[model samples]
Target: MARRQRTPRRTDDNLPSAIDRFDDAVDAAWGRVFRGHPVADRIFYLASEVGDFSVLWLLIAATQGLRSDEDADASIRFSLLILGESLLVNQGIKRLVHRPRPTPTEPRPLHVRSPMTSSFPSGHASSAMAAAHLLSKRSPRLRPAIYLLAGIVATSRVHVQVHHASDVIAGAAIGTAYARLADRCVPGALP
Candidate 1:
């Protein structure tokens, strides 16, 4: 008897399949929109780079910490908190989800950082929003700028083709949830 050839499993699912298709559309759109601007690509590359290991957030926390002794204490706390966030997202959660990063069909538009982590959730997106939440406490007046920076950092992950748009969206949600949870559970813990 001849054996039957097995086909790949596809549920023809609604939400999951729809989401994947939408994400692909967004990724393709991003490629088309930024196709030929070397300078724009470089800027995105650098923005994504700065998000590595939450360096940008740490810097902002340190700057805020420098303002006063109280601020210094808060800065230290916030920095540690961001690091803790990194640990949770990178080590704890990423290890469980083995999602792959987006693969570019053509030569990359610009240089991009090769990260060693799951693509299900973007670490850059997580840290950026988390830091925005904590650091905004330092100067409430700069809230808009702080969140804007966070938005830029989070989206840069997608623009540079290192992460899918859903990954970024989920990561931002996780980061926001974590920040809020930290605020509620550990009162006065974050800056």
Candidate 2:
């Protein structure tokens, strides 16, 4: 029997570590750009607000309520399943990791008020990526839009200082995998 080879673990010196530096640079640049901009500040404030996973629940409800044609309804249902799976995987991993959020003492200038939760594998990033992947699979024509939204949402997590770059990357991977799995489990569920 042949054994499967596992990918090596990423170390701090690898390319993945560069994400942290990139995040710091982005934070610094945005901080300087948005300094004293009340509107921008308010937007960040609202962006960071966590509402007990209300967005996921709403997606599920919307899917259930959808009464469109088979293709449309299936797509909606697939999206909802992806959202739920993403949330479950993201939250479950976060609980296990229990990593700490960046401290205010950190040198970066954070635009939004800090979040009060463990910060490994950001839920927002995970959910956004899952939706993006699922949507892109279902509607190839919308790939750009879906991925663009996912990128923005993932970047927002770092902008709000609620998640580290590593967290977002991990979340993206996990969410993408979960969505793929959900799609396999429920065929024709998403157009």
Candidate 3:
């Protein structure tokens, strides 16, 4: 019998393929609920917005803040560390996939602007999920707010059409896994 060659799956092939269908449904639902409401649209818009330079500075500040904290800040510091690591992982994946933005050739409208870079595995959604998972684990009371924010961040990518539904889903999974790994490593780091 002749051997059949197995082709390697592209990194993008590993991303969630169901995002288009799922996003359509989600968009339909949101369209019905927030129809013609500028405030609601703006809220959704802001939720998905990522100031690249600002986020980089914030992450740097967060790491510095964590390092400065004493025993009382253990949980917060741990969570930030986990989230930061997850964001790094997400960045790596984005580079590996190197998928183009959802609309590569078209001129994006003002409100729908996004960076002209790779778009598989959204960084914003990844960071938001990492923070939400870590915070939820550390403080039960904050779970609702954390999850709500994560959901909004994930949905925002689709709202602006910067990512397909699959990108956010994969980013969320990666972020969650990184958060769990970080949590496990944190306790061992303490002398």
- Residue 150 accuracy (lDDT) in model 1: 92
Q: What does candidate 1's lDDT look like per residue over 104-188, in tens digits?
A: 6567766777887899799999998888887786689999999999998898888878898999998999999989888998898
Best prediction by TM-score: 1
| Overall lDDT per candidate, in order of appearance | 0.85, 0.64, 0.62
Which ranges of candidate 1 are over 4 A from the true structure?
1-12
State TM-scores per candidate.
0.88, 0.65, 0.66
lDDT winner between 1 and 3, please give it.
Answer: 1
Taking the tens digit of each residue's C-alpha lDDT, what string does model 2 give over 33-150? 7534767555554445431253633453355345567655665576467557655855577668777875442443434545555788787777777777776765687689768756
How far is 84's C-alpha from truth in model 2 (Å)? 3.1
Better TM-score candidate (2, 3): 3
Index of the highest-lDDT prediction: 1
State candidate 3's TM-score. 0.66
Clashes of 1: 0
